[model samples]
Target: MSGRVMPGHTSDLLTLQDAGALWAGLTADSAVPTASTILISSLGSAQMSYALLGSHVVMAVKAHDGRWSISESEVRRAAVGLRAVKVDPQDLVRIGPFGGMPKGEHSEAVLLGWRRRIVGELQRPDPPEQVVPDGDDRALHLAGIDWRRILTEQSRDRTRQTWWLPRAVVRLLDAAEHVERRWLQAGQKESKAAEGIRPRSPRSQTHTTENLQVTKPDHLAASLRPYNEELKGLLYSVLSRKPDTSRKVTGWICTLCRKVPATVLDHCHEHGYVRAPLCQSCNAQERPDHLYPNDIRVTDRYTRLLTTHATEWLRHWHRCPGCRTRTTLPLSHLAAWTAYVACRPLRPTHRDNHSSRGRKPCGTLRVAWTGSHHTPHTCQLTVTIDLCPSGEHRDLAKVPYRQATEQFRIWLAKTAPTVAAAAGPDRLDDLPAQFRPVIPDKSDKGLGLF
Candidate 1:
């Protein structure tokens, strides 16, 4: 009676509420219900096992493994199938996220609740900085205070300049946008409130309107002055350039991107420091080459912008080394060529290992080449080359892959200058010897000779 609680013979106890209550009473003495005490009910070939574990009743349906496993909501369904009343198990259940958090509940509050509120404040026109009315303001105030407190914890680290510069840069950018919106909204509210105030006299109505029209919240600007200063200091420290001149230009946005407020001066790396203001997004595109946090550079910020233009060119046409015809090339070849032009190393591939949760398994890179066809009727030959971090391929320095790739890409670009450039000739007589066929003919049918 104390260990496993099997349902007794009773015609009226078919409902889930009756079954749950009976199981609870029977297992009152037992902390955990065992398989021996669990009553199995069959719905066709599948069997449902109900166990009252301490205060909550847990149920498991027979899986293909011939074992019962517990899930969050399936037990309720199992109880219903056995003709029991619907018993909600949510109160007695403890639900959690996938990975365990080491910093405990406070970390969860910051990460889940506090971060979400900040994100919502940034994305929407919600007036977060304004004082809330009585009961309505309590939750918002608490959330705002918690978020600010978490950020303040990071401020001590922000005082020093080091490898954390990129993180600080990102945080500053986010804070700048949030504070700018809040300041603007506060100013707008002040202007609206000023308009609501009764004029001193009918004769002074025009004067009141004029004053209200120009009622810019200098006080709000004064209060948010630190955010503006912090943004400038962080930009100057991390990017090694002055704060974007746009900050001086009222209501400035990126001339090129048109999406975000222009925050950084986009210095043309190829054009000897010629600069223009651009949004962070456009700047990212201009310098698509991602550097490790510590490897941030001033010049590489503009490489990807050029690379994008080159890629758009490659998408339309590439001259075939074999036939000397302008044709669409594979995307992989185009990407490889772009990487070569940008002097970017190939990105490595990752394979997930579920067996070991903590360790990251080794990765591999595969390079595939499609061989030239002698005739269109014959199948084109493809060779797949696998490169791994082992033995001779361990360092990747032994192969000179980067150098060879650069040389080959340069040769192709020059040979297909018609595709890569607007001014280059369509036909080149000085192609590399290996690229030239054994014999060349004017006829299209016999383009290549053995």
Candidate 2:
């Protein structure tokens, strides 16, 4: 249903159902969680903040980047007054921040079930996330290191960061060109000044690149490709730990950020090219080098960067849905207006990004599974006709698993030849495409979302 404009807030509109749910949630719970979509400015820089009503406001899906301001009222009159005169969800802030409902289309019962879940959670709040797990004792510990927060998505509660690879706990597999630049420049300085201290390299997992070597806490140790093998395995363990979560080793800095503890082992997925240690944020935005062919556009920096690959691995892994003859999603996203219709269930998640496109989302990510979270999953959904983000007809829903894979195969056959024809057979710079990694039989269970 189309939204009806609320009387007081000129910029905001509330759909009838959303208003009803907000009213019900507030009246019953005696509190309503703040919408991260709504924001108020302040002088302070705290990430977890709360503030009073202000004219300058916006909404969003905040990672650990912003503070949360949940408003609560003592007067019983405020709740009854809201029912008489409509109020937007933002008015109820002061209790806690909420990321809205579970995604995907569901029957009314599912909505009811989640509402109940919300009530149960509010009645008895979740325990503090800082409790240390067993077997985590260390002679030396990094102060303020919360393994649970580091391993999980600190952005929004729902972003779901950790995934399981065959041999690693993969929180992220992304790029950090800017950070890398800063790191390399710093290494050059370290190399020049510390020439007197040069010695044989302490053994590392990946090959250590720089000539100068030093002991713990040196910025170059974590940045170098080869790392100490024994520490490397222990280093990798921090990302994968769920129940027995442990704090990071002392002086192991993130290779990318140069600040914060390194939790992820940033390795190449296809080649198993183990890179250096990275904090969660530093590696969140890089396209894995193995995804595409090195081309003319890349040779000359005129073409747009491969930012999309770092954002959505599955989209590139399975290949983008069709947009007539094209695969680039921007082409598909634009094509949606003319060639596709929006699905009600696939509506974008709400956020007030101070723009008209606040409700926009790229596409949903899905994984097909057979047993439970404990068991391995197998499937063949390679591609689909959903070239546009608005098109909900993914490979899984539109075609049989085998047929979808075949269609993908056919597309690859046609596309690869076309690319080769353009590049010419003699071109030496182009790299072969990297296939998705193989899953091992006894791998750690990834997040259910993965």
Candidate 3:
């Protein structure tokens, strides 16, 4: 069967019986058909279906029946009316804007009412004025015409401007009018020239380059290798305990500065090197020596010192004794070192910075058991060794448990007396809630005396 009709061909006629026969044949073999051909049959069926099912069934059936003749002229007339309907109704509607349809059917009623009113208005008045008003002279001049003359000529041709004019005829008339206008304009120019007045030429046109070339700097730093290698090497030398004598090393240095201690011999031991080679003072103060290779320590002594004195031990690097070189370390190094020490297994709780059981040192040993506890229990012990304020527990490892406990008692006694003197008798009872000292009565004598 034929496909849908092309838009302009919508008014073509065909019989429903022929359309149905065509569709049955087309669909029989699952074959594709041309759009135009298929549409002929499709539209025929649609018209028949609409007739069978529409609200005004009897009228639809009569319209679709071939027995009822539908003239081409009548169809053409209907189509022309539809086209005219699309134009603004002000020209056809004689009524003022205020005279419109009632609320519910405003759109359709307004249009119908306007057409009727226009016919009435036209009959009552003299043929509508076609002359351009004097005020519209400037408008006509801007449009490249003499408005008054054009209006006078158009008024004479008003009878020719019929609603029944075909679109093709309208276009032809428009083209002819345009040519006539041009002829008139040329005549005007010639008259001006005859009077020795030259017409102005159109404005000169100019074009400029849209894209301008940009030049970039010739020398720009490309890679970080040159800037970071020295510091990275220094850090590796210190952490790995290997002297930086131009010897090959293997391990990951701090990715930022590419530095690790010498102690980290190769990649195999790289994971253990926590602190970057640059010291805290260097990172904080931004001094060159902070990146120097020789200034950093490779021995475990540095770690022990840090563990003991913490940040205080780091402050000492601000001045070097060996050459009195004002040493500076990276702040990152201090932070990294603290983190490493916290994670190390040297504390009594067997916890590190990564674990909740770890304690921040407060000038006292805080211990807890991992095993289950039964009755209330307490134990007495002693510790004795040199200790730095850095909280590094190095001395505790060296002294026996009993001796360490005894020294701790003695130290607490001497300090408590001074503290009590300053804070009053309540100072003795104000020990940390987490722990209780079990010193003999002799040690107690120093408690409240102040």
Candidate 4:
């Protein structure tokens, strides 16, 4: 007895493993799903219903667009005085996120029947939630579990960038350090009983260290290391102090940002000479000699070097070829480089473009830097033009953002306004009191303000 099989894609097909028919899906149609179905409008719209089958009764429990859940009180009330109540052991369950927000949504709609004898018996909590992992903390969570090891491994492979958002035991580290500082101030006055109780990082031993130490990977040559004598000597030799140059003769990182903990070596595209260490944010913003594919202003040797750099840069951000102003994105992000070369102007799509889904949906090819210069935040689609046809019309290619936005944005902002504001305020409005329209000015001119 397969119930409504996941609504709109309803079919008679049901695999034995996938069939959990405890709680069937509810559809939005006005008529009730079945005579047994009960409506719970207080929860939301009558999009779902509960069924009171013989031996037990299960009610609708979903709360939002996401999953079905009820308050703890509600669940307790439903449990009542019945004994041995639950979804079937064979029933496939899992509606809510496990371990997050105590309420779990079943993978399928499941109805728990309440029989009228002792009232009801409590259902066993989902089985897997009870299992504890071997040698893991009781409070281990998705946001922090294995992140330290993961970050350390990532830093090893990608030596150029090592910055990661740290989210583990930050407050603990601070409190531990404060206790140690107080112990140091106490000096000999402290009792021997308090000797070894000073809290330290789990990874640290005799000498205290940071919870997660940011260290240089082993493969990096000593010359590229921030504090190396070789790097220091080189900086002292060629470093000139200009108004823009913030680095002093004594400091190690005098590059793009004096702070921000630079981890990679910055080198010149033309000479291939190492300049200084720069932070990850500064490293990516380094403009290569060649701005675009066939840029003529840059030297051939430098352009060739930069072209190689762009290929291995990892990110697929590109500038508009036509206007050479704002950046552009490919219609198909998977093949961004190929799409940019083929499409002169990436076509723009409004929100309503499901009909064109045989092709990738695209909006303004150009995204501009809004609050910060490092990353672009705004995708301005006001000037984009849809030059190509859709999949039904024979799949069309993307266009360059320069062609889409430049002329159109300018016309809408500057040129198009000329038609509306061509003639200034009327001459009568500009006139003084004595030069204002007299009562006998003209028969067509009305005298009253009304």
TM-score against truth, every candidate: 0.27, 0.23, 0.13, 0.20
Q: Residue 194 in candidate 1 has what lDDT?
A: 49
lDDT of each: 0.30, 0.27, 0.24, 0.25
How much is 109 displaced in model 3, in angstroms?
80
Which whole-number lDDT from 0 to 100 does residue 234 have in model 3?
28
Ranking by TM-score: 1, 2, 4, 3
Backbone clash numbers for all candidates listed: 8, 26, 55, 26
Compared to the true structure, candidate 2 yields what TM-score? 0.23
Tens-digit per-residue lDDT, 1-450, candidate 2? 001111223233333234323434554432222121222222222211211111001111122333232222211222342223232321111111123323332221111122223323333433689555553311011110111221211222355322211101111111112222233344455545446566424332112222222221123335434323333212222333443322332134555445445544444333222345444444433221111121000111101112222222222221211211222222112112111221223333445477686764334322221222111123222222323345645532322333433343343345444432222224322223332242221111210101
- Candidate 3, residues 1-450: lDDT per residue as tens digits? 001122123254334444323333432332111111111111122222111000001011124234321223222332232233222211110111122222222111111122123223323334466665543322212111121221211121344321122222222222222222222333344445534754333211000000111111111112112223333212222433445422322122212223221211211011111222221112212221111221221223334344544333342232221101112122223222322332234433323576676754323322211111111122221121223345555423222223333442343235333322232223233223332221111101211100
Best by TM-score: 1
Ranking by lDDT: 1, 2, 4, 3
The TM-score that candidate 4 achieves is 0.20
Q: Tell me how many residue pairs clash in candidate 1.
A: 8
Q: Can you write out model 1's per-residue Cα lDDT over 1-450, one digit (the tens) per residue?
A: 111122221222234434434443443333222111233322122212333222122323334446543432333332222222122211111111112222122211111222233333333444679665643322222211212222221122245311111222222233334333433344356446646885345335323222322111112233322212222212212343335433442244443533334444433221112234444434434432212211122223223333545543332223222222223232233223333342234333344465555433233322222323122122221212234444333322122333443454565565556554532335444433332222211111111000
Runs in model 3 lying further than 4 Å from the true structure: 1-255, 258-344, 349-394, 399-450
At residue 37, candidate 2 shows an lDDT of: 22
For each candidate in turn, give its C-alpha RMSD to the true structure in angstroms: 25.3, 21.1, 39.9, 28.4
- 417 in model 2: Cα distance from truth in Å? 16
